[model samples]
Every structure is written in C-alpha cells, then in structure tokens.
Target chain A: MSIADNIETESDIGLSRTGKQREFAGSLAMPHDYFVLLKPRVMSLVVFTAFVGLIMAPGNIHPFIALVAISAIAVGAGAAGALNMWYDADIDAIMSRTSNRPIPAGIVAPVSALTFGIFMAFMSVMILGVLVNWLSASLLAFTIFFYVIVYSHWLKRSTPQNIVIGGAAGAFPPVIGWVAVTNSIGIESIILFAIIFVWTPPHFWSLALFRSDDYKKAGIPMMPIVAGNRSTQNQIFGYSIALAIVGVLPWVLGFGGITYAMVSVVFGMAFVYFAFGVLRMSPSDDEMKPAKKLFVFSIIYLFALFATLLGEALWTILL
Target chain B: MDNIVIKVTRVEDERIELNDKQKKARRARNIAIALLLGLLVVVFYFVTVLKFGPVVLERTL
Candidate 1:
C-alpha cells in the first residue's frame, strides 16, 4: 500500500488526534524526542564538515576557540533543524518518513519547539560572535536563516529547485569553519562550499526518486514529483558530473594534497557511476535499487571526500 | 467588568483537567531543559574566558 494509505490507517487508529490531545495524553516527552527535533544525523554532517574547514584553513586557532566555534555551529545547525521541524509539522505528519518526528508525533508542542529553536539560534550566534569572530557568527546566522526561512518556509513547497538553492545552507558550515580560523573566506573555503552545493542535487534527487510518492502526497515540490522520473534522473546525472569535477577542484588547484586528490578521484568516479546506473534504469523498475544505491553512495562519497581533506590537513600539521 | 471576571474565573475552574500528571511532567522537562541551557552558557563562558585567556579578552575589549 502507498504511504498515504499507511498514514490514513495510522491516523484511524487514534494517532490523528488533535495536537493538544496528543500532547496532553502523554507525560513530558523524553530528552531524546528533543534531540530528534535537532536532526542529529544531519547535525553530525554539519559538524564534521565545519571541523574539516577549521582544520584546513591557514593559521592556528586555540583549541578552545576551535571547540567553541564548532559547538556554536552545531547548535546553530540544530536550531535550524528544530525550526524546520516546527514549520513542516503539518506535512511531516503525512509523510511516512517524517511521521515519527517530535512535533508531528505530538511529543513536543509546536510552540515549545519554536521557542527552543529560536533561543538556540540567538544564543549560538551570540556566543560565536563574542568568542570566535563576528565573521563566522554572521555566516552561521545567515545559514540558519537561509535554512529556516528561505528553504524550509519558502522554497520547499514551491519549487523543484528547492534543494538546489537550499543546499547553500548546508554548504556554509565549512565556510564558517574556515572563517572561524582565518577570519575571512578564501578560495579554498569557496571550493568547499561549491563541492557540497553541487553534490546536494544529485544526492537529494536520488532519494526523491524512490520516495516521490511521499513528496506527491505531502504536496512538496521535489524534482521527481514535479518533473517526472526521466527528467530527474537526467538532472541527477548532470549534477553528479558537476559534483565530481567540483569535488576534485581543491586538489586540482593545489589547495589539497595528493591524498585528497586520490580520494576525490576515486569517490568522484564512484558517485558518477552510481548516478549513471540510476540514469540507465527504467521508471517501471519498482525496486529503484539503482537510485537507492546512488543515494547511499552519495553520502559515503561526501564523507570520504571530506575525511580525506581532514586527514591531509592533520598530516600537514603533525608531520 | 466585575461580573464578567467572576464568571470567567468560575468557568476556568470548572474546565476539565485532563492529565494533571502529564502537565507536571511537562513542567519538569522544561526545568531540565533550562538547567541544561544554563550549564551550556557556563561552559561557553569558561571556554571563551578561561581557555583563550588574555588574547580573546584583548580582542573583545
């Protein structure tokens, strides 16, 4: 059965009560529910990328300052996630993938989540500005604003290009990290941003291919839902090519070393291969194995690419 | 205004209190969160002032 039908069935079983009823039915939600609102997995990726940026940027930062900067970025990312959850609760309730989210599941009141998110956002930005440099703090604030206001509220429901444009929010972490250290953005930091920005479309589109029905049901304008599978697949392939080139650009420009170059070349090829596999698959293939494979590999590709850069930076520092 | 206020208070008291225990739990959670946030602020303070010391202080001042 479709996810829509599943949601209907779940709702029929008393899960569709008003938010107030659900909120009052249970005692306070566990701490983990609050954590879920932060979207920890996504936050982890933000933290890792930001850390890499901090490490690779020219100059040394006191370890404590670095820790504070990374912490502020993480909290800011989490705050954005919370705000996204709060705003998207209505659609999130209907989507099977998001049905269990804190607000939608009624574990946390929407107001509480909103307050928490806004509070964290303000606190994190202030801390970063006061402790680290104002440059990094401003970037973090902009990242949060872009994700919560521009992407979540505006673009997500309106356009198939949502992820493409909204991807900038995620791209800023590395730039923030770089700026935290160098107190300015450089060519290398811009390259880091470009890598994630180009990589996001193909990575997200592959997931959308398999879960197009979720977007359709939720009235979200994901690429596969708005533009048919073939077009999305082609776009994914095109973006993957761009991603591969941009992913290796740091090494090519001599910002990164041979180790980064090797990892980028291998993973870049792997990413393109997966996208090609998705491209070649017919729409009638219900399993969507190729798309699923591409989605999973895209994550690994990013992690490996960034980890290579981090490793290279550490090597340079230690040796 | 006096009569209206009296009636509102009476109505508010008569309203069913569903899940009084749950309300308590929610209050507890909020308190916990407040404490955690306060701790985080303290940590941020220590990291900024104690760890970075005069360099950070000089910049801020």
Candidate 2:
C-alpha cells in the first residue's frame, strides 16, 4: 500500500503506520513536508554564515549577484539536508528526537525526498555556476556531495567521529560565500571556515550527551555512543578550548575589529566555561543539565561571533 | 478453468486517493513551484543585467 494508506490526519501520524515507507504516492507529500525536508534551521545557519562571508570579503559585488549567490548556497544546503533525511529515514523513525522529520514521520516518501534533493542540488549548482563563479559553484556541489555521500551514507554509520568529519560539509558555506565575492580562496576566509568546523563537534556532542540513548537505539556511532560519557565530556571540553581560541582569531588576524574581538572573546570564554561544566558533571547525572546548558550556549556563542562579524561588515558598508 | 492473476507495479499498488488534505497539499506545492520558477527568472534577469552592465545597451545592433 502507498504511504498515504498509512497517513492518518496531520495531527496524528499514527505509530501504527510503518516508520519507513520506501514507496508511496507522491501526491500525498505536502508543502510542509518538502519544507521540513530542507531542514530549514540548518539552511538558515548556512545562509547567514554565507551572507557574512560574502559581505566581509574585500571586494564589491552587485547586490543582485550577491543575492543569487546566497540563494544558490541556501538551496544547495537545503538539497543536502533533504538527501540526509532520505537516507536516515530508517534510523530517524526509531529515534524519538528525529521521529518527526519529514521522511520518518511519513509526511514525505523516501523516493520523493531523494528525487527532490537530487533535482534541487542539480539546479542550485548549475545555476550558481552559470551566473556566478565556478569556484563557488564547485564548492557548493562538493558540500552537497560530502554531506550526502561521505557523511550521511558512510561515516555516519561506520565511525564515532562522524560529526567531527561531517562537520566539514557545514563549514564550507562561508568559504563558498567568500569565494563568490573574491573569486578566490584566502586564509581570512579559512579562519571563518575554522570557526564552524571546530564549533560543530562540541555543539553536537553536548546534544548527544543527553540524547545518547537515541543514538544508541538508532545504531548511529555518535561519539557518546562509542566513547563513554566521561571521554565524550573530556573531548567536548578540549574542543571548547579550541573553539574559544579559534573564535578569537578573526580579530587577531586583523580581519575582525575590536567589536568582533570583544564579542568573540567574551562568548568564547563563556562557551569554554559551559563545556567545563559538562566535563565536571557526574556521568550518572540523569538530568544532563550541564550538557543541556552547554548545548544551548554553544548556539548562542556561534551566533554572537558571526553576528558581530555581520554587524561590523554592515557598519563598514554604511559608514 | 483457473485464471491467472496479474501483479501491478509497486508504485501503482501504492496509488492513493487524494483526500481533501492531500489535494490541498498538492495544490499548495504546485503554487509554490510556480512562484519559485518566477523568482528564478527574475534572479537570472537581474544577474545578467548586472554582469553585462551598460555594455548591453551600448552594443551596436
């Protein structure tokens, strides 16, 4: 039977329905299904960081071109997210945290999600290449491939270091944005890339700290699943220290100003302090309150640093 | 005489009637696709204009 046979109303996506529906009636897929398929939250982060990268570059680009570049990157990121959801649908259905995702929730069928993902990925890359620089286009293409093929299909199931490596795919956006502006890659942009790359492990590990059961049940080899809580806690602390130092680099390297430096340093210290809390918390603590606190603050820390850079860039442009 | 039964393809077997919600969902998706296509055209036009600049208008016919 088609997945639609299984879909009860919107409110009740009944558990009675099979979790992973490989084949389904395409017409049953809703607009909201496709929207969530894009993983809007992740897309927003990609778009925001990319916009900052484009804005901070030492060159001028017409506003229209800039918009196209950022839109393409956003679409590309969305396409990758869709592919990830498609592949992970099986595991996602088992995990409470991911159970509501489009594929797992049966809002969208796996084949439909895959088709939409591939089509969007092709369009985003081709359009970006035709209208913008090929360098940026290639990076966009690579990011999608890396996220889908390397991370989702392979490392995610095979290794505990999945997020650590998969994190690189997310890190590419700022560099792609910078390249879109300058038509070249530079160290300054690499530092921007470093901020996201180093920030990902701890941020995800903190979430995994609390959601370890979910990952364990899903059979995904997340760090906390393979490594004991104490080890994962230690690693989170180490990455936090690294993120704090790297977070301040833009200011030290002269790309960021005093405002950027101040924001990064303050948030960076706070991030490390939160990680230390995670590190010191008793492993058996059922609440995982320290890990949860770190998880929430890590998001704020990244946003504060990037927001400061974005604000500085806008200020320079205006004044 | 016993008659042979035919098997349908998986997708055909999976065909579902579009309930009101499903129909509405499909309609919404169609509208979104149309809008995005229009946006794409606008983006391409603007990008071309920006890239070619005054040279396009200045070119000899």
Candidate 3:
C-alpha cells in the first residue's frame, strides 16, 4: 500500500479506537494532517525568538497584527522544515534518530510533505506581506529559500561548514521579527541574530557527537565524523566562548539593562561549563554524558536568553 | 539457479511498481501546490496594488 493509504488506515483506527459513536458522528472530518508537517518543537523556538525580537523593537505594532506576523513566521519555518524532510527522506530513513519520522513511518508521503511545505511557505510570506510589511515578507521568503536551497541542497552534503553558514538562515527570524515591528533592522535584532548563529554550532555539534554512529550510517559527514571528536569538541568550546560574548552584546550596547546583563552572564557561564565538560571528557566514555549535558543546556540557554529579554521589556514598561 | 532467477524477477517487479506509484503521487502533489502558490500570488498582488486595499506601513510617511 502507499504511505497515504497507511496514514488513512491509521487515522481511521485512531478515530475508531476513541468510540464508535463519535467516529460515526464525525466520520467525514479528517484530523488536520498538516500539523505533523510543522515540526512543532522547532516552530515553538522560532515563534519565541520572533516574539522577543518584536517586543524588543522600539516601535509599536498592533497586537493582533503582531500575533499574525509571528504565526506567519512560525508557519514559514515549519514549511522549510517539511520541505527539508521531503528532500532528505532518503538519508533520514538511514539515520536512527530520524528513521521513524512521519515520512519514513508511512504516515506522510514525501510528495505530500513537499506540497504541504510549499503551500505553507507561500501562504506565510503573502500573509506577512499583506498584514505586516514587505520588508518582513521579503525576509521570510529569502529565509525559506535559503534554508531549502542554499543550506539543505547546496551546503549540507558538500561542506563541514554547513551548520556555520546555514546557521544564518535560522538566525534571521529575530531580524525578520524586528522588521515585522519596525520595518527595519537595528542593533538589538542583529545582536539577537548573532547570539543564535554562534549558539547553533555548539548546540548541534553536541548532538552530532552523541549521534556520530547514526550520522556515519547515513553517510553524512558531521563534525565528529569528519574532523573527529576532539576537534569537534574544541570547535564547540570556541563557539561557546563567542556565543557567551554575543549573549552580552545587547546589555553592553545599552539596548538592555542590568537584569538582561546578569541573566546573560549567568547563562554564558553555564554554557561554557557544559562546553568545557565536553572538551575535557574522554571519547571512550561511551555514555557521552558531557555532550548530552551540552545538548540539554543549549535549549535552556536560548530559552533563558529570550526570556530575559522579555522580562527586561516588561520591567521597563511597568516601572 | 531457478530460485535465484525468480527472486531477482520479483524484486525488479516490486521496484517498478513502487516507482510508478511514486510518480503518480508526485504529479498530484505538484499540481495541488502550484494552485495554492498561484492563489497566494494573486492575493499578494491585489493587496499591494489595489487602491482601496489595506494601508501599508512602508507607504505611509
């Protein structure tokens, strides 16, 4: 059977399992399958960062329009993610970590995934353009294309610097968020972009270290695969330091206050500690405790950074 | 020798079947996406160029 048929069967069963009465009552109503295409965890981060950027900007955007713009950006990010999954389905099937994704699990066809992504991408850019501004719309369009074309198709297979170069696409959401509000880039948004760009390497490399075998099996030359663990660890350390410095840029540039500075300093120290653990630990430890620590810490690092920005914004407004 | 030949023939047949289905699915999906993209373009053009459309921030001031 085709993957589409499998998905239909699964959905039917899922609905039936709930109760026959409910299933009979709403037999024609299909669950929104496009939700799976969104990669919700990644979308959440994109939304949060964009929200922070929007709030931190100097100008005022109508609340409803701001919400729409953020939602559009999130949808666009998810669209890029779905398209990426469609293109990389072959390699994804080989990697254990991604082997059970909707495409490979027979829950969504690759073609369906591609269609969903393309639809969302165009809709998002158009919505943001109409409801928000052309600057934001154009940035959103370029970000989607950059991720799909430049990063995924061109850089991923050919270069070790894939994450480093492609990281810029991920970094653009905050700047896009800023533009959505003010319709222009500024020091604050650029600093936020820098923070994410510098943070991407260490965050991703940690996962690459622990999942080295999976990456190798997929024939993807990750940092640990190509450059070896020690070099990857050293690179992680260097990026961590740069990330820490960038984390403090908003405060230093006088766009933020003491609270953001203090929170950033503490966040940076925690990140450096985790990176140092990765650098100091032995490769043969097998459990990959340090790399795992860094991976978990990385998420907290971003959350804390943005949360602090929101906190500062609130404090300034209230007091 | 006969068994090996039969197994190889079956595999080839399965591969060909999968390829045909994949192609059909691809065409259907592409057409759907193209329609949606065209709709999006029309919406954007109307919003930007229509005189009675919503005010754009860039145009004001």
Return whichever of 1 and 3 wins on TM-score: 1
lDDT against the true structure, each candidate: 0.89, 0.89, 0.82
- Per-residue lDDT of model 2, residues A1-319, tens digit only: 5544544333223323333442443356767779889999999999999999999999998888899999999999999999999998999999998999988876777888998999999999999899999999999999999999999998999998999999999999999999999999999889999999999999999999999999999998888779889999999999999999999999999989999988998898899899989999998889999999999998888888998999999999999
Task: Calculate DockQ per candidate and list them.
Answer: 0.19, 0.31, 0.03
- lDDT string for model 3 (A41-105, tens) is 88899999998898888888767678778989999999999998988889989988888777776
Per-residue error at A166 for model 1, in Å?
0.5
Candidate 2 ranges with C-alpha deviation above 4 Å = A1-26, B1-17, B58-61
lDDT of 1 by residue, A1-319 (tens): 4433333212232334555555554647766778888899999999999999999999988887898899899999999999999999999999999999989887788887888899989999998998889999999999999999999999999999999999999999999999999999999999999999999999899999999989899999999888899999999999999998998899889988998888999899999999999999997779999999999999999999999999999998999
Which is better, 1 or 3, measured by lDDT? 1
**TM-score of each predicted structure versus truth:** 0.86, 0.88, 0.77
Q: Is the docking of candidate 1 incorrect, acceptable, medium or high quality?
A: incorrect
- State which candidate, 1 or 2, has the greater DockQ: 2
Clashes of 1: 0
CA RMSD per model (angstroms): 9.6, 7.7, 11.6
Residues B1-61, model 3: lDDT tens digits: 2222211111121112224545555455557658766865665565454424455435735
